[model samples]
Target: MMISLEYIYRYPIKGFPGERLEDARLNLAEGIVGDRKIGVGSGAMAVNQSGEWTPCQAFQRMTIRPDLTTFQVDRHDHILTLTAPSGRSETIDADTKQVEAGNPTVGDQLPVYRANGNKGYWDHPDAALSIINLSTVDAISQVIGQTIDPLRFRANIYIRAKPWSEFQWLGSQLSLGEAELDVIRPIDRCKTTSVNVKTGVADLNMPALLVRHFGHLYCGVYASVKKSGTIVPGASVKITGKSEDRIIEAAANAITAPALPDWPRPMRVSRTVEEATDIRSIWLEDPLAKTGSLSNFKAGQYIRIHNLAQTHTWRSYTVSAVDGSRLRITVKRDAGVGSQAMHSFNVGDNLTVSGPFGEATLSGKSKAHHFLTAGIGITPTVAKLRYLYAQGFVGKVRVTHVARTASELALWDDVVDAAKRLSGSSLELHLTKNVGDTVGAKLGRPDPSKLAEYAKSDKADVHICGPTTFVNSVMAALGSIDFDEEKIFLDTFSSPSVETEMRPIPASEPIRVTLQKSDITENWTPADGTLLDFAEARGVVISSNCRAGLCKSCSCKILSGSATRLVGEEGNDRRQTLVCSSIPSESIILEV
Candidate 1:
């Protein structure tokens, strides 16, 4: 069969593994018909002060039986129950709304959680349901030159169809009953995808596959449920290839054969680290490493790391260049099943390794000084720093690192040596026990402004890697200081802050405006403020996805106004942005 349906599963919990399914009906604005409809309050996830969204990490220790798939927790009335796969149901009652919602409680208060071991956390609240296409998984493997399991690209439903053999045709269309969905865009891969859910090691194969092959390893497509109904596992899937069928085939063929450097591949490891805390740098030992040209890799870019124990839980972690022929990867232990299984690994254990994904690369072309910032985020920057230094880059170079303590520095000595090797280079260290008085720490997070301070001399080219929020703050702070956004390079986490800026013209001050593609022109004022508020008034229905700037669903470009992007990118300051949540800081021309 060209496209064959084999497995259907429902993960009642978000990140935790799930029970396979024979079928599940997609329902209106919800998933699996009645799935997650009635989860117990488990205690509310309280954020600073007046309850914000719950933090998923707060409930990490809650357990669920691997065999059970259905459960419920009622907080206000204090009720909980479980439906075992055996069909045996158990129930309990307790009035714990206060506890589930994280309200003030006396003594050892814990989150009231639901069973089934699934996390309900989503990047945003409206991620009601998700689906995956097996073809994409197959395609990613071809590009990165590695075999990736379908489950690594997790989704509630896995479709089998014509495009299953094709790499990216899922963006075209598929008929499931009578439903039609516009493939909004790719579901971008994340760092979470790289963490071996089972082992917590920085595994690096799947990501290498995507970054090397497809330009980006993102394979799955996100869809708005066009038609809702039950989806059974064995049910038939029909793919109507793209009308430009040859283009479809071309794209499909490309996923497996994307161009990249031939690696003196990293050697594979033969032993596993049994301890949970050990850094499992699984290598693909090439016999020539002792005397042969070693496989060279860049920093910040990651590789897919497989669980020698469970292939399904494979992940990616940034590659750190400890030497030319060999690579290093670090792991923070996971408390879940995936990490628990990785606990069986002992050093020298082997897991498949693919890539040398080039998420971070050298653009020595810029005549600007190289400002390398390192910390937890320096994995990629370290590679870049070493790459530049080894290439005899003599231009002005400086290294700035922020660490909690001197001893916590991972590879600090190596970086110091590298900085010394460069002619006229400078290395400045920023260590903080607290953000207390450090020019950096007090801000409470990383911001581009703080980074600019490290620039010290000229506004040199910048590259940053860190937590998404830290990166976001850096990007935002950098924008405020007028740093050339484009000059800044990144291998970053996508934070939903990339948005446009709009402003109101007082009713007495009429502003001339034009909508580029729509070819609409009008004089607008504060009376017709809010770009969305103004557009809808003018019958310019700016198509929007989430309207909250988080989804990047309504990204458009600015033709005129000096847009201060909500989510700042280094080189993209001159580009347009998300209009859904933008406020006009000035008169601007926009392209939708």
Candidate 2:
């Protein structure tokens, strides 16, 4: 198979048209000379002039400002010219140092400043080059029934390679012209790609379509320049070497990889911090971080940990924070089996864990967000708030947390820092136990009728995390205020009052259950409580977080027969069943 560079693009100004290049020079630790060196402030982002890297949300981009794609850009000797759809034109005089466009559609004349010096401003701080496979874009075009403009992806390097082959190139070394690159990881696509380059209209949901059709959220690859040199179009591309683990992962991606969450892996507890009298925060570090397994996790997701004494017993806890390959979970000491096991752990101990699972994660698409949490339920909210702070979000963020006391507050300082970092963001604490004891906290529980005051707008994404009663009350109150039910997200991983136990099968022909991936077949009996219990008894590790069936981590596809959900909300796809709560009616084959 022949692979060659097809095109090179340089975005002189972010959110503006890309300038096609005939030839460009590459340097180590820096991308194309002028690429993304300057970006204009918009929304909550202030003008940055210190040549420092800023998050993409800090500047106008096609993701939120699709109208910017309607303009054409050309740079000749520092003078940047842009032409609007109406043929009206504007120019930025780069020689004066700071350049600002006068077009209304382009960031509304937002102040522009050059930053990041030679490194330039990139979506990923360390990733300098974005490489795209033209064939992969064409494949998506075919699936969407429309021609796709690769420029919409805003990638710097475009290559002509086998369709979807670039995904397999991750963790591999690439050679293009005189430059060498370390293909780091697959680029998870976003709504930015949905914009029509010519019309500048977002006519499609690109990320949703990718998940629906391809079963993954990746398209291009982000590479770091290992050995840089000048390169032009038509330069030959070659794979120099492949990492063994990545090769195995590539093979899995060709089959059932995308559907499978990370199975239980033993991570060493590097540190344990006492956040409160009964609450402890444990930080676990993945030994093999090079595989990048822990890096894909999102905020507001939780991990399932196996009970130390009872390996079969698993419990779910929301991840409080993630730093590189290290993830932290804050747990409160309680009579619960999982909580007791977590409290017994110490530094240097290894814990069996799986899944950063849960549907309650942020899209980072919306600007306004409101969080209402109570007691220890602030774990997930803190994680999400930190994400917004890192993105430099300036929009209104309303946080209302109810706690017994300030000392019992998990991540209180972290939440306060987020509130301080985001301008116009508010943080209010409600102390139901002793309100006057805490400095700025209200004395009593919040009135459900007055909950509408917590949100600035009805369109704000409302997140509720707390005890069942608190959650239900807040949810009902938010509903009363006419908040969009669909826009509200909840962390409902609480255990049911009555835990379902494995029951004996009826005195009839035994049910035959097959685990496809495990290649195991077993007969069901009364002793096997549920499909999950049966799989575990057979030495088949079925990835599961909440054994009560809330997180849906142990969900499996039914190839034939039925193992229906016992209770809970129906999943988007009916073909899958939550094995923890599901019982085999007759016989079933599960794609485990």
Candidate 3:
């Protein structure tokens, strides 16, 4: 199979129409020439002030303002003409230093800036070229029952290849024409890809559809130029080298682990640091840096420590961060048996552990995101915030952390630093006793009215993590404002009331379940919350990382009767169910 480039494109101005080229010149250390050299920003968004690379939120983009796609731009010599869908037109002299443009929906007369660097205003900081396979676009079109235009992807180069073939090129060196390039990673699909370039309407949910049809939310690959050369549309693309672990390289962009089995292994504490007064951070890794190092968990997930010497019981703790192959868990010492055991562990101590469980995570969608936390609850949110910042998230973000005093604030530096990295992002630290930082600090508890005012108007997605009292109060506040209930995600660290589970429901009957591979059969009752729980009680191990059903690790095919999934479950096809969040409705046979 011969892979050839099908098209070449450049977006001279960000959030504007793309300019097709007959040929393009690729340079070493830089991507396509004259691509994304300028960007337009509205009054609500700030233009890059540092004369350097800034995140995409600083400029107008289709993710936020889809109406910008209604315009078609053509530059002839020194004259640039922009024509709207309604036959309205505007012209700008390229010689002029100041460029002004107006949109009917967003506002009028937005400012355009010409960035002064080779990096331009590209979303990724690496100044790389984005490539998409036309076959993958065709597959998405077939699934959605619409002919998708390849331009909707906004890639620098379009190629003719097999569907999903680009994913194999991760970490591989590719040869295109006379240029050599290194494929960085897979590009995660977002709301921008759902917009129709011609109609300016987001009629399709690209992220959800991709995750449903394919296992992951990815369609394209980003490559950094290595060797300089001129390339035409029909140039051949060849894979020059392979990646060590393509799965890990490809999944680095999304919150997913590799397709591997789960086991209890001993992880050694490589290092420990005092994060705050009573808070300590420990980095865990494989003792020999061998097989277990590949367990790349996601942010907001927790690891289960098993068989502690003192407690002799299994416990779950939030994995605060992931540094390469190491897992960092921040612990605040308390009177709990697990906390005391963990706090006593020193460097070189071994602990048996499994997991990276939980469903509460950051959804890679286009919307304002608010993280409301209290005291040590900030652990998971801070981890999520750091991951978002690294992925070049370009959306409105607000983080509110409440603590007794500044000395007790955990991961304060990480939160402040991530806020600075993300444009249009704000951090609000509330201290009941002392106000160490006056810049963004407030005294007293978080007021529900203020929380509503910040999140209600934008309909932002809110993540609340704290004690039972704090979580309930925040839930009530959002409910009082009539916020969308479905948009709120809660940390599932606490158990629900026993009375509620005991209440009778329509399909609360016992059902027979057969696990084919495990060769186990059991009768499940309402007491078993989910199929995963029932299987665990029966001594069956199903490969799982995030037990929240968001990560499709526990997805199994049904061979017989029907199964019902929970209301908010996200993954699985017609024949499959994520056992973590699904239950048997009647007698069922599972492939397992």
Candidate 4:
């Protein structure tokens, strides 16, 4: 049966009551035209001072003032009116007011403040719209043993659908009325959901209830407008095919078979050589080059390589050298399985290689280019230099390569040679250790003076890539030199570090993992590296690639409980976790 939109609501001011809408206009860039166009703030956390969006915690919310939900709000053009349950009313003009005078108070104690803006305010910067499933709300109500009001979720659109069916739409396109939206991720539930709309009381613990029932505290889905148009209540909704399958197939074929356009074609390793200490370079060519040559790629692009016969681990490496017949990738040996396996590759070895992807290439519109990198991060810069040398690019170019020691410089000679071939190009090498005039390179890390000199040009495009610390340092140095942030492009191979500390699940205290789609529950312990490993061992097929959590192929919604995502340094605010690196912190339910 087809799902239909049942309700539409818009919050003219964030952290306040929402107004029901009979119809709304969705824009590709801005979600609902007037939804959350302004936000309420108070004291030092005010948004008017900085003119930037602040987190919900900085402002007064329903969690702190449940009475705010009892206020009825309506909007007409630029004027907004608010009416209290006690028959008190206040009207304010949005366009002219910098701050409303003596605004409504919560519990007659805390004063409410408002921040006006034309640009929409949002929780997640990219997600402009949110949707919830009616059946899922009903199911949650049944589990909580209460008649739950869907308005507690504060979603823009409520759709009538099968219970938990909306989770399957992740990464898929949804056609609602004349507008199209791409479901990006599930909306993680917050303390706001605990506030009861009817009684104006924080009575229900929605997050705890969600964890008790689903494993993850998510109640709705966040979407981005793809094709903008008008949408109204009762409009039909259509979800496209499963996006998880497409991601899995693309990743698998990228390493095993040949898929055109999006997927990489199969190639054979023609040669391998140790370029420097702990560094290896491999040349790849189309096995069936007689039929057609390999696909052409612009400079600064990288390819994904995986050995299906060995393991599912895949790693991306920048194309160090490229030609009509073949391409080469330089690798720095690490403790990781992918790098170790790539280091063991011999000539004539069959391996799957996919697509020359990356956007930090030499911009055709740029009149000057500057590259800042360390160690293996210089691989893409080398490719760009080679392209410039071949094309006789006479524009100004500067490259700075930094390494702890001279031995760590993998492609020093190639970069020097390419710089000499380019008429106006220059290369500078820096050594953090081993400083001497005879070393033929600068001493210590990158200096701000060099970046300032390069950034003086209006048409200069700066690219930086390396370890997190190195990248951050270079960015800071660039900023000190007044470099344009918009012109800076970065490519880092490492994922953000996981911020949350997770204690290992005790072997004695087995964690129960329930897979919703398969209706199977498995007991797991610390011995299982991650939930993905445990699930796969039990023949519970889940899509996964880049087991290190860099690739989000294994990301799934946590229906209940919690999972420790061991990816990058950033903490996951979303309810979804990467199953490959996630260990169950408690008895968890996953909608994989």
Choose the strongest candidate by lDDT.
Answer: 2
Model 4, span 230-265: residue lDDT tens: 999999999864344343333223322122222334
lDDT of 4 at 49: 48
lDDT of each: 0.47, 0.72, 0.71, 0.69
Candidate 4: deviation at residue 131, Å?
0.3
Question: How would you encode candidate 3's per-residue C-alpha lDDT over 1-592 as one tens digit per residue?
Answer: 7899999998877777888889988988687766777676645445666546655666777866787788778899756676767777766554444545544423467666666555567776663689999987887787658899888889999999866567556557889998888876566555577798888997765655554444345678878777888888999999997434543333343223233213334577899999889899999974312333335556688876754442234466788887766788888989876788889999998676545666646766848889899988888876888878878888899988888887888888887877788886888888989887656688989896679778987668888888778888998888788888878877664211111111122357688999898888888887775787677555565664334445566788999886776635323334888786678877988897
Model 3 compared with the native: what TM-score? 0.46
Sorting all predicted structures by lDDT, with the top scorer first, yields: 2, 3, 4, 1
Residue-level lDDT tens digits of model 2 in 1-592: 7999999999888778888899988888688888887776654444455667866666777755688888778777988887777777777665455545534646366666676467777776666789999987888788668888888788999999977667556667889899888776567565577788888887775754554444344678877777879889999999998545654354225322333334344578999999987999999986435455666667788876653443234567899888887889999999976788899998988765655766645666776888888888999987898888777776778888898876787788888886788886888888877755666888778776576555634357778888888988987787787767777888855332323332333444578988898888889874575787677655565654434454455789989888645545432234778887777776888898
Tens-place lDDT per residue, model 1, 342-411, is: 4555555444343455444466665545444545565565566777877777677766656665444565
- Candidate 1 ranges with C-alpha deviation above 4 Å: 1-267, 270-296, 307-311, 322-325, 334-344, 369-374, 434-450, 453-457, 493-592
Clashes of each: 71, 5, 0, 13
Candidate with better lDDT, 2 vs 4: 2
Where does candidate 2 stray beyond 4 Å? 1-254, 258-261, 435-437, 456-458, 494-592
- In model 4, state the lDDT of residue 286: 49
Candidate 3 structure lDDT: 0.71
